[model samples]
Target: MTMHLALSALLAIVLAWAGLLNLAAPAFVRAEFEKWGYPPALRVLVGLMELCAAVLLLWPNGQRLGALIGGLVLLGVVASLLRTREWLRLEYPLVLLAAVALVALV
Candidate 1:
């Protein structure tokens, strides 16, 4: 249980940081999104969804839902990176998705 909580906290923090970057319209995020052919406006929506998922991770009852949301978000990210042949960038989302699955299963 302690390990589960720790992983959840870590995932939440990472998601929050990434979400904030998306919301802030950082140059790198904008450039990456543009390169991936995603609309700039979609960044804000994804960011908000990620923030919600992070919040959901704080409670036992919400953990599964949080993991589900996080997994879906990472799935999209992985798909996008794959589509662009950005194999190197695939590590982050794949790792995050695995973490989310761990939390969901445990």
Candidate 2:
């Protein structure tokens, strides 16, 4: 149980930091996110969603719903990441998997 909580905490931290990075450094993943011809607005929206989700994810009863949101966020990235195999691969998907796992176990 504790381990699940700990893992959730770690996942939350990762997402929170990722949100910060994306919001602060849109260029970091701009090209990758744009690969599907998505607009810059999309990238901005994803960052905002992630930032909000991270906060929601930290609260006790919010975990499950948070995971759902986080999963949506990752699913978007992973779909694209799979196509590119990513220049900065694994980190996003791995954290996403962790979020999913936390949802399952918690």
Judging by lDDT against the true structure, name the best candidate: 1
Q: Which pairs clash inside model 2?
A: none
Q: How close is candidate 1 to the true structure, as a TM-score?
A: 0.95
lDDT of 2 by residue, 1-106 (tens): 6766766677678778877777675665776656767787787788887877777667878877777777788888777776776658768586676666566566
Clashes of 2: 0
lDDT of 1 at 58: 82
Give the best candidate by TM-score: 1
Candidate 1 lDDT, 24-57, residue by residue in tens: 9879889988998889888888898788889888
In model 1, how large is the Cα lDDT of residue 14? 87
> Per-model C-alpha lDDT, please?
0.90, 0.73
Q: Model 2 compared with the native: what TM-score? A: 0.78
